[model samples]
Target: MDGVDKERVQKIVYEMSKGSKYFENEKRKEATINQKIEDLRAQCVLLTDEQISFYQTVADKRIIDLEASRDLSKTWLHSDMDAFYAAVETLENPSLKGKPLAVGSMSMLCTANYEARKFGVRAAMPGFIARKLCPDLIVVPPNFQKYTYYSELTRKVFSNYDADFIATSLDEAYVNITDICNDKSVSSEQIASELRNTIYEQTGLTCSVGVAPNRLLAKVCSDINKPNGQFILPNDYKAIMTFISSLPIRKVGGIGKVTEHLLRDVLGINTCEQMLQKSAYLCALFSEHSTDFFLSIGLGLGGTDTPQHKLRKSMSCERTFSATEDESALFQKLADIAEALSNDMHEEGLCGRTLTLKLKTSSFEVRTRATSLQTYIHSKEDILAHASKLLKAELPLSLRLMGLRMSQFYDVKPGRHDPMQKTLKNFIIKDASQSTSCSSYSSDQHLRNGANIDPSAAEESCLSKFESGHLMAVCEPEDYQQSNQIAPVKVCRPGNDASGIKDNADECVPQVHADNEGRSNPEESLTNQNGKMLWWIDDYICSVCGAELPQCFIEERQEHSDYHLAEMLQKEESLNNRRGLLQRERPVVSLVGKISPVGDVARKKQKTSKGKFIPIDAFFNRYKKD
Candidate 1:
């Protein structure tokens, strides 16, 4: 019996023998005590506290003993689908069976079915490489929405057995059945079998479970016979050590290529037990953390204070090459890494300003360097530029491992409906598009979908889950047609004439009164009235129906300069509306844009720059009409 079960048995006895029941009738009480003892003995193998604790002792000892002799056992269960995505695809499309298959994108593979594994196709492998291995392999894109639904169902199945059942990831979990089966009655083998059977019945998917004294052994044991099988770690330490020591160093936590080489080549330590033996040496070789790591493994101390479910602070993607060192090859690999990292960011609606580069040398010198940009960048070019710069600055060194980490996240703000800020953001967008603007432009312009633009493929998957927004594939040319076709109304620029008769231009720029009276210029006010009137004319509504317009008008613009002024206003309104919508629609990605009130100091700056700062009156006054 385990520690959990032993406590339960003692508690049951104390509760039953404590008081009045035994004293009420000595003859009856003696029989009841004997029966209770027999019952406890019967459940000793699989006993847990959750089992019924009989407060009222029974009178029949022989019957209780007979019940105890008829042994009842409990089995631990773990069920996971084999190559969950590819398998699901195979199940639906029968033609996919017998043929190698994988689930991922054109860039990389997420997971491969067993058939694909035989041909050296594996998870995270580049699709091109996988295709070379198995030319006929069918590649299916990931259906994350369906995967999430299935994950929730799997969690529900685990909870049905034990609310305390711990899920490690999407497809893995551990259950402590010691409390469920009581101390003496149930066997671990029995518990394992029933749980597997229950999961199959509920989910129609088979899984493998491992029964052990603790979770550490259970995880390792479970992987031994996968795809509907179970294994148990017995009551022995030396045998367990031998089993663990024979495995690769990668099996041990924190034992990457660098650490593994340090242990095997430098320290002459290879298996778990060998590494465990040299814990002190490892501590000195690496740091305090490395020492604690090996020591914990040595003692089979797996569970830590770390909670099972916590938000991932950082996400990284990396790859190891078949060859030792090539800078050009590393560049291509870096591009792939950047694409994957950015795609994940877009999916999670996250933006990270910090980029980290990880490298491993042939001599196994692990080096890492990171730099944080002024703004979050999600483009492949930007990611590669930064990562490559770090590598170049730190290189002329051999390489074995390379990784990219996107972290130091900033939340994406929702769309706003502010007119002035919206107009300003558009001007910035125009500035950014004219040049190779970094991610800051995308961040400032509120053009988040710019990061999702895939130049290679015309058919891109656009998913806009928000009610007000859309997942528009830029390739869908028709979606932008109507807005793009509507040319901007002509607004004449105030050009200078050689004659110096600039009455029309000068009249528009109304001179302030010499007395500095409160009387504002009527002609200046005429432009203001025209703007207010024109704002009502072309502001973001159907001129005919007056219904609120869709966002497409602001996004799609004609190249003609005639409509520049009105077009700018329309775009500004659209940006503001989009910004407002983004903020309220999805607060998770909200990057809060504060509005600072313009004071006399700001006016002076605007005046000197000739409205470069875009003061309200100059913008509306100068560009309101033709």
Candidate 2:
């Protein structure tokens, strides 16, 4: 049992955890796993010789592919702080150094120091159970702020060696030292030693470092020499293959407890060598991704390169509380969580379309409900609206934990131009020009005289309208400004009659309008009542609403028109339903089809009620007369 006193530890753990909710949950999980193992064995028994041969052929091909992709030139170093959180707490209070210590509360243990681990107490095990095993265990509440400070100190040393190091966690990092090894005329082992020394000198903390040809081997080697030690695997292929062959599959990252059981119990594959021997069975049992991973491990191949830049895939905020069934209290908690999530998104300049609500019932069951929006949302109001809907759907739920997660992130980077922006700009410009040509001089005069516009005011107004209309697909604000100048101009279509403006010739600037009007005044508009030039082009108007939109680009004007059209459709649908008339279902339909059975019924009902139902106004008049 890897030097652990398994029987004694198990007895203590069982005695402490018996009859507890957590223990019961573990029992249920164990039973589920046993059932799955039995099912896997049955499937194996039913497999034929032909199927096994086919699977072997597939595994052989996959191994060949993985071998072809292997790179052994670069040197990678994986560094992990020894009992990070526990060490930090000890450093702050030196009196607790030799004593057994664990970080976290009685419910859960985050990390345990070497002294505590001697009694088989480890991270993630409940503190109460740990106490039963090691009676002298000193449970210290975690101090994240202290840990972060020391983590930063260690990272500073890492930056000196590899500027683009990957910090996998608060206390662990993967650094590529290939360039440094070459530059300093030293080996990877020497570099790792110096790094460890530097970290100890700076933070007064002990750490373990491992140097290998790739990150996977480096990480594995880092744990071989426990706390305050360094290990180096030679860059030779033979050395790596020898080391990986005897290594347990469980020791490899990504192969968790369930996978370990599958390899050992089902396939009788415990070590990497066994994995290679039973590769055929694995290919048949697992998916392509898992098969590839197992073969890569067996071949001692791992990622040799770390990504230069990392983009966040998802962001979440979660909290645990006493189990409660109060609906009002739960909603209040959710509202606070939504607000926190919104603040984080806004601070990071992130907007996501998908929102997920995660809850852990008092019985330790986890449930998640996700909903996606057509547009990205960042505000607290939008987050709360979606979260409330999801929460209400699962109402009367007694929860011990609640969390909000947002994913499918939008690229909210400012000043980044989209490829579709130019095409959308051209479409809007063409439509706006067409709409302006149809307008008469009376309307143009009305805009010039009555509409009060200022350059900055118009710009702000257009921006607000663009955002409200969800025109992100068209163009960003920076792109819009760059494509179109924020200046007022009158668009005159070619070949239009200029009779109305002919008398005021001197006041107008002669300009040629494309397509419909050849001769017209490009500038004959009056200033606002405040004497500020209204920064509006006479050509930019919403065709649907016939409302003048003071936008600098065509895309903005078109988006404004689309927003109005959507509003009008919703209003029309409501009005038709009130009047007992079936709404036209052409423009608005479910994803499946435009004409559904429900729509057919509504239409039939409308036809039958046409002559029987009185008009809304007539019905009201009849009631008044009575």
Candidate 3:
């Protein structure tokens, strides 16, 4: 049944897939891949022997460079749960064990057990197509909560071997166990054996473990033993290289179905050894990066370090629904997505400056629109505002899926030596009355230094604002519910400045104002209470640009400042046009007394033209030259 039943499975799959939307889409992709292969073959045929030889020289050099960079001192392990989701499902209900089971709906299969795989039923195939292959295939709807619980248990086991194990997904991880093997004076095989046994003992789940000098070979080795087994490749270079030589290129991580077909069909590179032999043709056919990647695979080299501390690039939430053409319903869905994204951001203590709207049309076409803001935002109101704007811009969109993502994070929490706190302490001490204790003053204390401190009065005012929907809670309720946790929100009286309070000290306290019609105007309320034109200098503010910020957790302020500087240059260009001076012809003047191509003349104008326009880059670039 190794290869004999494959054709029967294929015929059944083709019959089940024929005329279906998924099949049609797959056919279109296959056609595109076939055309690419044909093009590559044509390109190879057109190349002269001299040109082929030149590419071969370049590829050989690349291979030498890659092989030189390989490190055999490290022990890398790849551990993956055996049919993870299916295993978890069967574990929960032992009756489903040894049965051909698949997890996910009829629309798609998430994962299938080895029992199902015997019938050629696989992950990512539509459940109906899988059913056609194996009529007895049991389809179970995915339970992410249950899966997450078991995944955490497995990760707990992984943490014992390597604290910084890189979890690629819920079921798989790449762990660097170099220190463990060295410190414990044990072989990689022994370590992997203990890991597998511990996981099975703890969670009643079996996992495959592969140990090699690098992640690439380790991952390939893991798959060799299939379910509930372990494989180890020695650190010897000859053994590692020999193992890779016979292995199919398709078995490598980065080589997908399309790349596999192209290599096999066009270059006739079925194995890693064939890839090295055909490297010259691949180098000529593919980009430099692609060529390097193929050669690295042939040399059996891959990333050994697990980047555990890498900050998440973005946080997002999305859901799929039945296709809908109703504009109002779409807007409602957008709002829901915004709310979910806000909750996720709050839970993670993250706020993002960029809001991205992702929409999948009923026809399966995906459209994404992203907008960057002057400030970091994590509130539902703020997210909804930007998301709605993007959504409306692409009006009358019929969609099946909607998503909201936030990126460019900033931490809003205050540091130990927060500048805002220092400023507040200075102001409080300067204005303190004789009876006031400036150093020990609690947030609940009323200001005796010309300011009224009425806790009851302030609480009433805050409650009124909350009831009117003008005041929004800054922190999640669960945060305060934890024992020994400090409350993140504080109430302050309206028309009374509470700049000294920890919660409001560095935050942009929106001043709600009543208009002539008694309606609250949020736009006018953005200004300071004294009616002065000033920037929102909250914790998320851009220090250089004076622009209000969204999230400030991550180190993106420098990048955002550069963005502001770029905008200032564009403004300067526009100003130069209005003044009838060509931008390039006009000599750049220094705002500060710094290095200047035109000498001291640029610095002299700084005093006289104090209110005039001064671009940030022009000022900084002069100093940079100096």
Judged by whole-model lDDT over C-alpha atoms, candidate 1 comes out at 0.49
Superior by TM-score: candidate 1 or candidate 3: 3
lDDT of 3 by residue, 117-193 (tens): 99998999989889988899999999999999999999998898887788899999988899999999999999999
TM-score of each: 0.42, 0.68, 0.65
Query: Which window of ten consecutive residues has the lowest lDDT sum in model 1?
Result: 521-530
- Report the CA-based lDDT of candidate 2 relative to the real structure: 0.66
Q: After superposing candidate 2 on the true structure, give the runs of residues whose Cα lies further than 4 Å from its correct spot.
A: 1-4, 412-626
Error of 2 at 144 (Å): 1.8
Clashes of each: 46, 7, 12
Error of 1 at 420 (Å): 33
Please list the C-alpha lDDT of all candidates, in the order they appear: 0.49, 0.66, 0.66
Backbone clash total for model 3 is 12
TM-score of 2: 0.68
Backbone clashes in model 2, listed as residue pairs: 493-516, 493-517, 494-516, 494-517, 494-518, 495-517, 495-518
